[model samples]
Target: MKWIRARLADGNDEKGSACAPGAFHALLEDDRVLPVRGDPYNGHERTGEILRLDDVRLDVPVVPPTFYCVGLNYTKHIATEGLKIPDKPDVGYRANNALIAHGEDVIMPADATKVHYEGELVVVIGKRARSLSPDEARGCVLGYTMGNDVSERNWQKSDRTFWRAKNTDTFKPMGPWIDTDVDIENMETVVKVNGRESTRFHTNDMLFGIDTFISTMSRYLTLYPGDILWMGTDGHSPDLADGDVVEVSLTGLGTLRNRFVRER
Candidate 1:
């Protein structure tokens, strides 16, 4: 089961969020009474017009967005990059642009010397939460999805913090789709740079697991229903070239694909 919010991008249309309530629990949770005007997820609910997927574009899945991201979430990434290991998890900061939906072109600044793509598993929030225990964190998760925390390396590592590095316009590419049934907390993900595997890591090596990370972050800020935790990449962020097809993949949510082409 999955939960998503979608809208038609071809023309001016109102977007909406819905539960993909199916025999699956995530789908079961959707309000079947409210059907989407179009989209595949609507057919199961019989609430809205079943729009052809090819006919409309997908927006970032969640609405009423609250974004929370992490740094150094993966352990192998730290080891491989020869980065200083933090005594505790490095929850450096969260950004404003990490809440994007699917089918959006991630921005690549014209003046940037180097920009890298981070393939990660994203945890989406299902309820309003604050200071949750590790055990309670997963319960509040709406599901797991894929994302690319596109970063500008110089700005991220050299600048004060990652604010300018990771938060560029459309830097967050999420959701070919979302699924709640999968064990995304334990999945292995890989980032392909122009069809070559750059970084791949299993979640077992993460210094702080999803539960602990989410719980820790909520303490610093209020997390709302549509909040998301962008799991930082697994180190091997290869530089992207114009017209580069950057693909990120997780075990259950499949591949979130986006191409990097310089704006004219």
Candidate 2:
């Protein structure tokens, strides 16, 4: 099932009846969505009223309780940067404030340069998991979505912790929607800059795949439903500039496109 968070496009009033109070609704054919009523951390439903997708403005599909990311997990990304592969996963956290929905503009910091896009597959957790084995890890996944791990390269190198480099407002563009039935192991990722293909890689090419990362993370802390993990990106990306449009596409998951505009 495909899921989305949307509100009627009449205005910015998010209290519209198209979706539940705080949960994502399942998308249906005929441009409609099944309203989900209940806590998303557990399970939800399509029991409520149906609304047209075109009539509502799609928001970020999910706002994860804990946004985690694994860097340098893709072999090509490491090799391209001439970085040594780590024996263990290099996991990190991303601020929720960085997230933006599809059709949103990524406001590039006026003082920044060397902003790059890292097209990646995002895993959304469905069930609570702790100390799970590789076999059990995959079961915890709720669905998959597309994301751009936008980064300011200069700040990444100079800052002690990746604050401004990775956590700028509107930096992370994830959506279109989430697909619950995607084949995570064999998906293809394609990235476009200004409508031109810039990077392409198979989802399974990561040096450390989902099973490993999920299993590893579970050993440290409990992962609840609605938690999300960004599975990193492959290959290199050209620096983004004002007016540049970036789109990240996963084979089964839809494309997430955002335009970059310099902050005034």
Candidate 3:
């Protein structure tokens, strides 16, 4: 099942009522979306109202309580950056404010000269867990989604932390929807800039996989429903410019596309 959070596109309560009841939905096989009574973690009771997929606007799949990230997980990406691979799985945090939905514009800061996209697989947690074993970690995940970890290279290098460089508003474009079933081991990631493919890699080609990150983080902190972990991307992105469109596609999962625009 693919879960989505969206609103009717007829301009009624467009900005307001994002979290209103019946906003959560399930994408049906017949190209329709069915509003559900509850979320994916708890259980989704059908609302019996089905609408054409084209009649709705997609929103961020979920408003995550915690945004987690795994850094330097991809070996190829690390090698491309000329950095040493870490021995242990390390988890980082990202701000929720940076998250935007598919079709949104990623606003490039006026001072940012080297903006890049990191296409990644986002793990959506469904069950509360702590001290999980590597094998148990997989059971806690509800599904997977795609995310674009947009970064400003200049600030990323100059600043001690990625506070602004990575957490800037609209920097993270996630969602077409979350796929409850995914073959992670067989997945592949392809990234395109303005209709041209720029980066491609095996999605599971990580130095540290999802199970490691979850188990490592769960040892110290609890993983809760609605929290998300962004598995890092592979390879590098070219310097993005104004009006450039980026599309991130994961096998079986859908594509997440966003345009970069200069901040006015």
Best by lDDT: 3
lDDT of 3 by residue, 1-264 (tens): 888888777655564533353455566555778877777887768777777778778889988899998889988888887888899987898999999999999999899999999999999999999999999999899899999999998898899999999999999999989898999999999999999999999999988889989999999999999999999989999999999999999999878999999999
Better model by lDDT, 2 or 3?
3
TM match of model 1 to true structure = 0.79
Quick one: best TM-score, which candidate? 3
Q: lDDT tens string, model 1, 80-118?
A: 667876776556545655546655666577877688887
| TM-score per model over all chains | 0.79, 0.93, 0.94
lDDT of 2 by residue, 1-264 (tens): 787876566653455454544335566554776766654456666666766776677788888899998888888798887888989886899989999999999999888889999998999999989999999888999888888989998999899998899999998888988788988767899999999999988887888889999999999899988899999889999988899999898887878999999999
User: lDDT (CA) for every model shown?
Assistant: 0.66, 0.85, 0.89
| Cα deviation of 60, candidate 2, in Å | 1.0
Model 2 vs. true fold: TM = 0.93
Which structure is stronger by TM-score: 1 or 2?
Answer: 2
